[model samples]
Target: MRVRGDDLVKDLKKLRKGRGILTSSIISHVGPALGEADCPLSDRELEILRMVEEDRTATDIAYALHLSAGTVRNYISSAMTKLDARNRAHAVRIARDQGWI
Candidate 1:
């Protein structure tokens, strides 16, 4: 950030102006703060993501669980929303990393 003599003031001003607001990752917490539940995801959502982590297809999981495929997908989608995940894999990753599943 060293600028020559008189240019230092102008350079610093420009740098300060360009320094945008800071942001951080949003994490969902459970426990007393939430007033209920141990994790953000429900038991069913955790179960589905665990199966997903094992590389099971949605239809396969539905068959094994005696639930509809659409229901399984709905659980996955709900988990994704709760974990702020971009996709099914991301949801699993987040849940696993948090030890939720």
Candidate 2:
């Protein structure tokens, strides 16, 4: 199950050529042995979740980001759905645990 260093480098080169960004995409080079296969949250979702982790309310986040409170709530909801989290607190915990925020 050990991959040679040269093989790993070659795989990485191929991956870099085929896929420019690693975000929102799974890298099969290492496979499931690394952990979960996908990161579904977008950058906006991560940003909102980071604010949530800091105990910021949707309204507070909205003011800080110059977005509507409803928009902030929507971002939190989207992140929660992606993370399969039950609430804002849960979403924060999941994101933190996964090192996504």
Candidate 3:
């Protein structure tokens, strides 16, 4: 059966409430690199990066953005390559350093 969006939201809220903890590691990790110097990010790339900064999983981002996980992965990979980043964490750091996200 298909679940409605409201139902999904309610379920998510319930799960979050059960967890009873809101962490702040995402900002902490990306804060230092917020301003340095590098290339600029496009609007779509920035959106994807922001979602990444929010600590959302690739699968979650894909679902939220109505994209295939493969597509999300490709965007991430392309971003990483353009930034000459070694990995996801490095890409985020580079993007933040460039003031792209």
1-101, model 3: which lDDT tens digit per residue? 23466755565565577852211222233334574343445676778878888999999999999999898888888777666567777778767754667
- Candidate 3 lDDT for residue 71: 88
Q: TM-score each candidate.
A: 0.65, 0.64, 0.59
Q: Show the colliding residue pairs in model 3.
A: none
Instruction: List pairs with backbone clashes in candidate 2.
Output: none
lDDT of 1 by residue, 1-101 (tens): 12354554454455568853211022322222445334778888889999999999999999999999999999999888776678999888767755677
Candidate 1 contains a number of clashing pairs equal to 0
* lDDT, residue 43, model 2: 91
How much lDDT does each candidate structure score? 0.70, 0.73, 0.66
- Check candidate 1 and list the clashing pairs: none
Q: How close is candidate 2 to the true structure, as a TM-score?
A: 0.64
Sorted on lDDT, best first, the list reads 2, 1, 3
lDDT of 2 by residue, 1-101 (tens): 23566866766676789953442212333535677555678999999999898888999999999999999999998887776567889878766656677
